[model samples]
Target: MIRHIVLFKFKPGISWDDPRALEAEGMAAKVGGEVPDLQEWSTGRNISTRPIAYDFAVIGLLEDEAALDRYLVHPFHQEAIRRWREISEWVIADLEE
Candidate 1:
């Protein structure tokens, strides 16, 4: 399986990020069915309580390298990423497991 991880920190003065989180999570919930080659997907938003770890994280489990590449170039994922970039700072890592 391919595991895709992302961490995000919201930009100052941006408050719509919760909706972004919801949207991302919602989309992720639908991935395995709508998009081929996905095994599972999940996303989480940061709570107001502070933690030493990175802000928010998203975890996606996919079928293989090709599926991961498909996710990378998928239009829906691209759109979500564009929206995310507008709202926050982020870091991403994709791993094989």
Candidate 2:
């Protein structure tokens, strides 16, 4: 299964230039470590784009939907998301395929 994660609308002025933002993404990526089913992980902070809906995009390929859910509720994910929420606003969607 392919799971796409996009996070949008950070607090105004939080740019990719911010070291904190960069570190946050790095930490978020680490969440994949806890889930063995994640076949591939791709993530990035938007560099330059016109009218992009999100500030970041993280894509995960997993063995199955259950593994995707594990990725969502993973302890590292909870920790990383908690930290992100403290710094910015966000919205996400799960595309099932």
Candidate 3:
């Protein structure tokens, strides 16, 4: 399986309570159930108080590269990406497991 992880950093002045942030959070929460290729998925705000920690994260497990590719382009995922882009920048890592 492929383990896909994404970390998001909110832009300057953007907070968790921002409308755009809330929308992105809601969209991300729904992607797992909406996309068939995602075997496992979870997303949430960071609880760490330390500096340098990302504001949000997403972890998804897919059966293979093809499934990972499909999840990356899924409409629900795309919509979440669009919403996130409005409030933050992100980095991702994909690993084989």
Which candidate ranks first by lDDT, i.e. highest? 3
The whole-model lDDT of each prediction reads: 0.71, 0.72, 0.92
Report the alpha-carbon TM-score of model 3 versus the true structure.
Answer: 0.96
Question: Whose lDDT is higher: candidate 2's or candidate 3's?
Answer: 3
Model 2 over residues 1-97: C-alpha lDDT tens digits? Answer: 6665657556788877888787778876786675666777777777657675667766777767788777778777778888687667776666667
Clashing pairs in 2: none
lDDT of 1 by residue, 28-68 (tens): 45554665656776767667667455556777888888888
Q: What value does the lDDT take at residue 12 in candidate 2?
A: 82
lDDT of 3 by residue, 1-97 (tens): 9999999999999997788888889899999899999889999999997889999999999999999888888888888898999899999999999
RMSD of each: 2.8, 2.2, 0.7
The list of candidate 2 runs beyond 4 A from truth reads: none
Every model's TM-score: 0.73, 0.75, 0.96
lDDT against true structure, model 1? 0.71
Q: Quick one: best TM-score, which candidate?
A: 3
- Which of 2 and 3 is the better model by TM-score? 3
